[model samples]
Target: MPTFNQAYWEERYKNDQAQWDTGTVTPPIKEYIDQLSDKTKRILVPGAGNGHEFEYLVTQDFKNAVMLDIAKEPLANVAKRLPELDAARLIHADFFEHNATYDLIIEQTFFCALSPELRDAYMTKAHSLLAPGGKIAGLLFDFPLTEQGPPFGGSREEYIALFGNLFKITMLHRAYNSIKPRAERELFFIFEKK
Candidate 1:
């Protein structure tokens, strides 16, 4: 496997090789956001490449939306795309190093992009980032875990085993609204901090 680090992602963005980026927010996530009644919730989207979700949140009148990425390129792209958003909200730092807490964290392609070895760390970091009663909600790939991807795949059983101890598994099931390419191959989940 390649490093899957800052440099690797930066290079991917520079070369326009970010195949994981869907030019718009995924349908499941959009539907999830559409039901949110609290527009004031402190929300964070880590590894938010291109920040389509961030843009959507802003459009929906969410006040405390934050977008974080390890690489500068994507964050810069977000800044360019949404120049009116506060610059401070576009964070360029390692996700584990980020210190603030949030009421809701949005996870899309972020988790699967990490090396499988970092799974535990990702869970731990996410747990620490949430305020009391906070939740991490989004899609996780539902395919096999293999040695061949930044878009690494995982199963529902594996997710339950990994996240069950630290979070309340509010929902974990096959996503009914995943985009065509990911149809039936992703799990829509809502894991609330315990």
Candidate 2:
């Protein structure tokens, strides 16, 4: 198992080992964003490597969007790509230690990239970061949990068990519009903070 710390991710970006980057906003997430009527909602995209979703959010006029990552490289890439984005919103910080609250947090590859031991911590942190009635939404890789990953795999049952206590599982189902490579392997979810 890898340490999966900031240095590990920084090295991955420096070496161009970010195989998880899709170079475009994911369809399921894009559709979800499209349905959102509040363009002013405070949004956070943690572990936002390359920030394609952040780009989409900005393009859609979500001015309060914040993009965070433990590694500086990806944030720098996003800054370069979207030069108009406010530099302050491109936060380079450890997600676990991040303290601000948000109305919505967009999850992409962030959850799977953490060590499985941090799953509970991730949920707790996410819960803490959301205001009451706020939501944490986006895709979760739906596969069996195993020891072989930075891109760790997990199942729907595990997710419900893991997050159900602190959040209302508003939507947790197989995503019908995932990018082809992720096809049937993802679940689009909306977990409202309880």
Candidate 3:
């Protein structure tokens, strides 16, 4: 199993080879963010490469948003675009080692980028990072699992099985508003920490 480690991901960024980067936040996530009334919610976007969603939160007036990644290039790119956002809010660290809590964690391609062995750890960490009643909302890919991918895939059943122990599955279904390429192949979900 190819562990999606910092070095591996960093090299991909260095080569500008992030095929997963949509260059903009996906439509489904935008819609989800649109419903959020509280701008003070402490939101965390881990593995936030290039930070499209991170910038979106800030532009939407989410004052407590944080963007964290293990690579420097994407973080630097984000800094260049959103110069006014606080440097403290942009973190360059491993998600597993990050020591803070959030009211919400926005997932994009982050979860699917990891090896299967780390899925449970990712669930555990997400549960730990979220405060009581906090939630995680975002897209997860829906396809077969294979060895050759950073953008790996899994089914809704597998995800429900993996996360139901810790989260209340508020929403898990096909994403109707994804970008053209991702439309039918993704699932939009909101899992509230119990």
Q: Write the per-residue lDDT of candidate 3 for residues 49-162, one digit (tens) a residue.
A: 999998999999999999999988899999999887789998989999998989999999999988877899999999999999999999999998767787778999999999
Model 2, position 1, has a per-residue lDDT of 71
Show the lowest summed lDDT stretch of 10 residues, model 1: 77-86
* Superposition error at 65 for model 1 (Å): 0.8
The candidate with the higher lDDT, 1 or 3, is 1
lDDT of 1: 0.94
Reference-based TM-score, model 1: 0.98
> By TM-score, how accurate is candidate 3?
0.98
Alpha carbon lDDT of each predicted model: 0.94, 0.95, 0.93
Which prediction has more favorable TM-score, 1 or 3?
1
Ranking by lDDT: 2, 1, 3
Cα misplacement distance, residue 142 of candidate 3 (Å): 0.5
For model 2, the superposed segments whose C-alpha errors exceed 4 Å read none
Model 1 CA lDDT for position 139: 92
